[model samples]
Target chain A: MQDLGIRVLFMGNNFIRLLGGLWITVKISLISVGLSIVFGLLLGMIMTLKNPIVKCLTKIYLEFIRIMPQLVLLFLVYFGATKSFGLQLSGEVSAVIVFTMWGTAEMGDLVRGALISIPKHQYESGAALGLESRQIYRYIIVPQTLRRLLPLAINLATRMVKTTSLIVLIGVVEVLKVAQQIIEANRYTVPDSALWIYGCVFFLYFIVCWPVSRLAVRMEKKWEN
Target chain B: MEGQEKLLEIHHLHKDYGNGAVLKDVSLDIHKGEVLVLIGPSGCGKSTFLRCMNGLEQIQSGEIRLDGEVITDPKTKWSEVRQKIGMVFQSYELFPHMTVINNILLGPLKVQKKEKKEAEKEAEQLLERVGLLDKKDAYPRQLSGGQKQRVAIVRALIMKPEILLFDEVTAALDPEMVREVLDVMLELAKEGSTMVIVTHEMQFARAVADRIVFLDGGEVVEMAAPEQFFTQPETERAKRFLDTLSFE
Candidate 1:
């Protein structure tokens, strides 16, 4: 049981496999984050409209996303929809779809908060300056909204990256999945290898997320000053 | 007098909020290049009247004309009217994210559709006029209340409006800061820009206003030249209001 020993941790083959799986995870996160930001901004703008119909539609979408768990959402997209609707979605595509839905809702709410937090007088001042509605947004509303929304959006990006680990459960062969395979193959020779493998996975996630967290903190401090 | 034209005309202007009227049947005429000051106790609808001129507040049933064109018409284009009538708010609502230069350039570039370089050149001149040229690159948060209000004035002027509306522009400033903004306004007045100001500064109004309109309880109580209105004050309300301020 001790034949493989702790030496497997530094093996070149194990490192290459982990990096390959991590590359998949990175691809999923990046694609999902980009889609979420574009859709979320549009939805957020719709939600802020004075129309009752648009407001209600946005509220329904936001609440639906908020009430459902992300894991359940992934399962529905990956398993339930594929079976019930005769869909032929791959694990990676399913993960992207589910995470983008979740990220979009969260980002939309963040955008709404940023837009509304601006003092009402800012709009009034724009009107007084003879600015049209389009001009008001271009010159006044958007610039301020972007400044407040940037940090929150960065935090959301980090969240999406961390959450990519969950896609391994759906058989995506991402980072955590590779870690599981390594630990399973060496279970007889390397005792307690699962714990060490999982520990390494933790460090990998930390390495990806730590810089983003530092950037968020630095931005907050810079803006506050 | 024969050549000078009336720039603004407010006729029987009535404004109401829900059940009650805020401004009731108020009428006045302001001539070109004249400074008209509206002074009254709080809640007297002076600000509301100023807001109506710029189409910020809708009137219930009355007419406001700017240079012989009916501005209060529902069909009249507000953006067009707004381009000619620049308003400075009480709170000095400068775009907080933009630098003083950008804030001033926005109106010129957007409403006036000036090119960036041309807008920048005009903004530089306006900033210099307001004594804020050195602080062009500074954001609103970095400026004092007086400086912010002066930047706001430049922001409005960059549109090159024929008439300027000042809605208690100095009310938000410290006592020391008030004079600086008022001095800027006085300079604009000397340059022959027609101006309508709502103010609590009785001394400044007395010193600079060509006509003083005293309002109370949502109605104009007296409208006359500064000298006759202050000394004679045809209405008891105007005299009583002046007496309260005389001690201060």
Candidate 2:
């Protein structure tokens, strides 16, 4: 039996390399999720409008993004855009941009659902109370919409964090990329390096996502109360 | 009593609900401190007429004047018009997630931009009027149907509008829950708050309404004192309406 060196994880600065990769993954998700939320909220509001032009435009954007898989979007932005649009975009930048597009579409749909789920009488009640349109949204409509959306939004965030593993395909050097690097370095010396490193990679992703989903469930419970 | 000043005047109002006219040539005058109860069968335009006064529904061709200011004109801002007229609904439409005090405080605090301390203080008294002072910290879901309706009334009163419109408010309440909400309205009536109420409660209409307006088929068919209307109901449609509600 070939000696399975479990010691490669403890190899000088190797664990830190994995942590650095984890940090990169976290950074990409945060930046992408944050940008997606602001744009998604506006898009969501636009999608709810009765204006035909705005409704049609938002519908097109949402439908187009939703129909294309995120990985293909990443490929198009990373490789295809630089070739076709005469623009230069780094792998990490492309990853962030692609995730934002994907996340925004999902987020916007969630927000639209949340806003429409509210009874029509709610807006009428606010208007009848003499609230201006802005005040109606700020005080009544927005608050209720937010409460209905928070849990789903958080769940989307978790999905973003997990799906970020795909960024390794675009050469972003995220956690999975770092695991592959570790396995490649020990491939000849350690027989079980792939299994060990992949197991750790799986553990890292779980630790990142499980708490977020748990928080989502807990917040849903709180919203119900 | 006939010399009272007109508070809200709807003249030759018409409203279309995309397919056809819901309100046709409707006209009405609500006098200051007068409790006018609107009674009609479903789809008779009473609710549409009530909503038109509050600018919750747009009228096709007409003028609604509140304190002599034209509200139905194309240039009139709904927020400005609605500030003078408060409308409550059958569904209560209370902000379910908010505490009772906060729900009442929202209009005064956000719309009127009143101080929080002052709004909350007055809201407490208004809640007290509805006998829900103890439920100030409670959310709408925690309250009974009657309690929610009463809280909704308090929400409107805190705005201190010149006139209040009630759109079939008691129609959604349980038999036991209806009176508590009606009692709040009766108290407001005794206190001389000018109110336009769309209700099915004949006893409430007879006791509190200074005048009753019977609407049917998108038109006002009869307008008279509540006792006279309850006993007389000039039109055949109104007579049939009361015949159905005789048990109430």
Candidate 3:
């Protein structure tokens, strides 16, 4: 162990604070991702509508999010939006806002891809069965789309959790933020504290995201038949 | 024949895709219990004509009337009109997420607003009629191509529509699988279900069809009794088309 005394992992309340920071990370991701799913699903469905104007507007929004960087977006929301709009926004709220925008666009595109991939024959079958357009989507299209979207959606969730680390730049005090604070506090006593603390943060993210990845794989296997 | 009630009437129907026409000035009548088999070479618009009957494709001009009601006018709602017509496709298009029974029951339970028990009982009977009762719990992926087609037929039949449109339902099946689906259709014909089938199966048409309508280049080239059409086709194009089929 090189006798570097790695006790700081459990000492001076560092462990509990890391866990608290992790909880915040999970909470933000859960809320933002959940809301994004709802918004994305609606956006995706709207994008499929026959209206040209709606499609054009949604395309612009999707392109805007896809072309821009998340950090740039975060900076704009945190630094620019608050100052320009005279709104008092916290780092956590800004993070949520920025992540939701990105996640919703990605998820919306995933949903659109899944929806459009269903053969035209499927809709014809639904029509032949006397299904209304709404009923066709509810009873046929959306269910199939959901099955196709599951694996990608799970992957998106993990990406969201890891990407939540970006919030630290805006001072969200999440896991990575807490790690930085711990390392700076122990910079004199524990020379190698950065290594241990950052390592713990890495594993914390890995632990958070690993199960979701495994779930995606299991789902793909089960649905392949 | 003059006094027979017409279940569906197509009046000079015209349908067009963006680049060209698919059905042009076509007129036909389907009497109660009549079996009208449409045959033509590929791209002859037989399938498109069948689709227009059920409002899957909107006609550019003319009108379609079902049970004496105008069903092709812009005011007509396809969802309501379709309840009187059922269609089966070359690719079964069975809902992969649903079990066989659910696929059959979906129309009745959701569209017709039948109770679960009622729909399930009807689905099982349709399944039984097609010799697929044992596979009711199976998903579409678990079934053979023929089995999926059979379930698809049952899915349409469970609606008990007045007219059934079959668009080359056996074309995608293996040679061996085609017999089972054809047998089920033959059974339905024996039961006197009104049917419009677009197919290349000359033997089946000769056996079951009351009238054979030959279409070519989006036009109805000829209509005659199966014996008349098969033994003595009235049009040169149809004779050549049949000649091509026979060489295979």
Candidate 4:
């Protein structure tokens, strides 16, 4: 009430910059999530194969991704690859690649869990009913797995959105980076703006993520019956 | 039944779980319009034998011919063959996400590519036969175990398979509920449906079986008419098996 210093956000295009920054974050997350779902589904199914070699290879992939830190992955894709392999990847492109790789692995594991959670008798019943293997997945397995996977996947989606803040480290100019820039620019004119600017960023993240969490909860409750 | 056409033929079937054998050199034949019941000690591979008939369990070495086509061959289209050999499980494995009618219509409409209207009509008739026409819209989870088992039966019957395999279908049902499911199978037997049933219900087995195949230790100990097999068993193993049943 005394000197809130929130007026700096209203000064000349600062809020628009924040929206643009959030758009960048949302775009990256959407693209990564879309690709992760398609590729993750395939990886999940492959992981469930009975072949020993396939199982071993997918195990290696899943473990490698899980063991590596995402920040390190972003650096390797952004800085390491350009210097060592001479690939010209932009910061945004590098962020998407790293996030997608991480998302796909996590999502693939989720899919594998869902697929295996189905009872063995379900597949046997489908087969005994003369459904082809693909038809079994299409008509029987996938429908059931989707029902089990959706709420978990929505939680994954929201996590991805929040994690997109990490992209600011790679200089992708997302919401967190824009907030920092605005706070630094107003540091002298509005000495107390850091708290307000950071608070606004937290609000922005909440507005984006809270509804998705609620949606997941609603779907889980509805499906429970 | 011996002179009738053979709907299914098996020769020297062998199955193992990589550690040891489950079915060993088992051979049997199912004739058209015959109800054959397989009864044995638990884990004697009676259920494994029924599953093999439908290719649910792959025999390590055997020949299973369905109407003279060698369905045991690796290249055989088991899915196409399975269309003619329906199976009901110990657990009613109804598609839980689907209503009763959809579960019944799935095979006919998807695998056979039948007209939806015709399939739906047949599904209703089958459900009606099982006294489940009223439950056509209910999910599997909403039904009692016996009701779910009847729906499973209807789901199998709509395929109109040449032979149906029942893997202890009523083993999981309550005592009072078992009668309702058994009555349906008894009616099918009366109407001369070819069936292979594995069950521990000796009374129902005696009533419904045209022939009873007694298995012990993964081998066919005896095969005789239910009257002969139940009354005066030929083998010591069969006698001991029947004696244990009487003890219960």
By summed lDDT, which 10 consecutive residues of candidate 4 chain A come out lowest?
A: A216-225
Error of 4 at A140 (Å): 1.8
Where in model 1 is the C-alpha error above 4 Å? A1-6, A9-12, A50-64, A76-90, A192-196, A214-225, B1-3, B115-119, B243-248
Please give the ranking of all candidate structures by lDDT, highest first, separated by commas: 4, 3, 1, 2
Backbone clashes in model 1, listed as residue pairs: A1-A189
Candidate 1 has what TM-score?
0.89
RMSD (CA, angstroms), candidate 2: 2.8
* Superposition TM-score, candidate 3 onto the true structure: 0.91
Best by lDDT: 4
Candidate 4's residue-wise lDDT over A57-168, tens digit each?
9889889988998888999999999999999999999988988898898899999999999999999999998999999999998999998889998899999998888887
Q: Report the C-alpha displacement of residue B113, candidate 4, in angstroms.
A: 2.0
Stretches of candidate 3 exceeding 4 Å from the true structure? A1-4, A49-64, A80-89, A222-225, B1-3, B18-20
DockQ score of the complex predicted as candidate 1: 0.56
How does candidate 1 score on lDDT? Answer: 0.88
Chain B of candidate 1 achieves a TM-score of: 0.97
Question: What's the TM-score of every candidate structure?
Answer: 0.89, 0.90, 0.91, 0.90
What ranking of all candidate models by TM-score puts the best one first?
Answer: 3, 2, 4, 1
Candidate 4: clashing pairs of residues? none
